[model samples]
Target: MILAADLADDRGWKGPNSATPEVVELSELLNRAKIYPLHDRPENFRSPSSVSRKIGNLIGSHPSAPRNALRTSAGEVPIVNRFVDDRTPMKRQAADIRVRIRRGLL
Candidate 1:
């Protein structure tokens, strides 16, 4: 949406030299916003555990597993990259993501 908005601006859609009113209205805005990963709401969140394997063991799925919580020098636990579940919440399930962007685990 940001990119589109920028593109619209660059294309003289919102300037003094604008041709007709090429205004992307709220309905069009809704349609455009649907294309991106929306952080504000749940799309297809996953179980906080079982983040690694499609078939998760208890250890792998447990949120407080020692392995899962192990911290790096940066003081952040590693993310489950290979089997990343889009279902995972941007908040609790991925503490590192929250910490990196929003400064703490909620």
Candidate 2:
């Protein structure tokens, strides 16, 4: 996930109008991205698994299952669960991110 995000950042988020303005505390980012995960079967939409396979494996899968993934087989993959765009509140996200930085998550 970090790698992919870095890739996205590297590529300037690809395509026109890709800027993730106000990524944190952004409703659209949270709504379109956040997920409640409960993975036991095949998923319907894309996830980090799909992202790694389809986008780039070096990006890596999100370490923890997303917050909104469900037990349903037809659940949307990246929706509500993966990092389509940034959603972590800037301040709250800092601590966790600092840990990641210390551990080289980026």
Name the best candidate (by TM-score).
2
TM-score for all models, in order of appearance: 0.16, 0.21
lDDT of 2: 0.34
For residue 93, what is the lDDT in candidate 1? 33
> In lDDT terms, which candidate is top?
2
lDDT of 2 by residue, 1-106 (tens): 3333443334434411223333222222222332433353345343433443322222222223334422223223342233444535322354454455456453
Instruction: Give candidate 1 misplaced runs (Cα > 4 Å).
Output: 1-4, 12-21, 25-27, 31-106
Q: Give lDDT tens digits, candidate 1, residues 4-101.
A: 22222233322221122222232233333334455753532222221211112222322444565323222111222211333234224333432333
lDDT of each: 0.28, 0.34
